[model samples]
Target: MDPRSPPPGDGRLTPADLRLWAVLGLALVFLALAALFLAAPALGALIYGVPAPEGIGRTALRAIGARDAALALYLAGLALFSTRRAVAIVLAASLVIPACDLVLILSAGTAAWWQVALHGVSAGVLALTALWLARRNHSA
Candidate 1:
């Protein structure tokens, strides 16, 4: 079979495409962010809308960074080596991250509107992308 002719579906908009670029794109994004958060927890917290952390608070940010890095590896690994369905399943499951972040940030009442909106939009996009991949995987 021609490598150019990817099997039908797999969530690619075109036959020549690999596991949707969105999956890989998101993975790369997370990886970059993970590095930033790991290297500079305070800055990462600020970017995430948290005020500059003090003392032990930085530990939590580091934990978040670690988690993000781990998730990024899993996502990228799946996109590269596993099936598209696996990527969709993982992406769908990962929705809890942004959803919980939105809720937590909102409940804290310390976040600006854009921060809250960012999380909300992230959750929305992840949900939509997961659904699109699933539906397209089934029908295309």
Candidate 2:
């Protein structure tokens, strides 16, 4: 069989495909949250336990929202339209965001432990997902 052809049998997705779908779903959720942040920066700051300074805080939150929305859109696009290898590569590269988030939360002396922990957990999950996708694509 040609390696470029689809897998044998019906066109139903494999488990690995489902995992990619899950990742895409998660990205959509992230996009929605980013929109929320953009719409209500003060609310996002409250949730993250950050002080909502008059102007700077709102501006920063909006910037973060924009960054997150762009990242999420890029990831979702990869999952939806790219080859498995491409998705895996992008997923691996995307880990930087969560890793930086964890560090930023930790560096902010006033940030709650839970916030830091959340980012750490997010980083770990993204790393694991990327590894899984990469390995699966390689074995196929």
Off by over 4 Å in 1: 1-15, 137-140
Candidate 1 collision pairs: none
Best by lDDT: 1
Q: Estimate each model's TM-score.
A: 0.82, 0.78
Predicted model with the maximum TM-score: 1
Candidate 1 structure quality by residue, lDDT tens digits, 38-69: 89998887778778688888888888889889
Q: Any idea how many clashes model 1 has?
A: 0
Estimate, for each residue in 41-124, the C-alpha lDDT of model 2 and write its tens digit: 877766554666677768988887898798788777777665555666677887888787766666766678777777777778
Q: Residue 45's C-alpha lDDT in candidate 2?
A: 68
lDDT of every model, 2 decimals: 0.77, 0.70
Model 2 spans > 4 angstroms off: 1-16, 137-140
What TM value does model 1 have?
A: 0.82
| lDDT accuracy of residue 90 in candidate 1 | 86
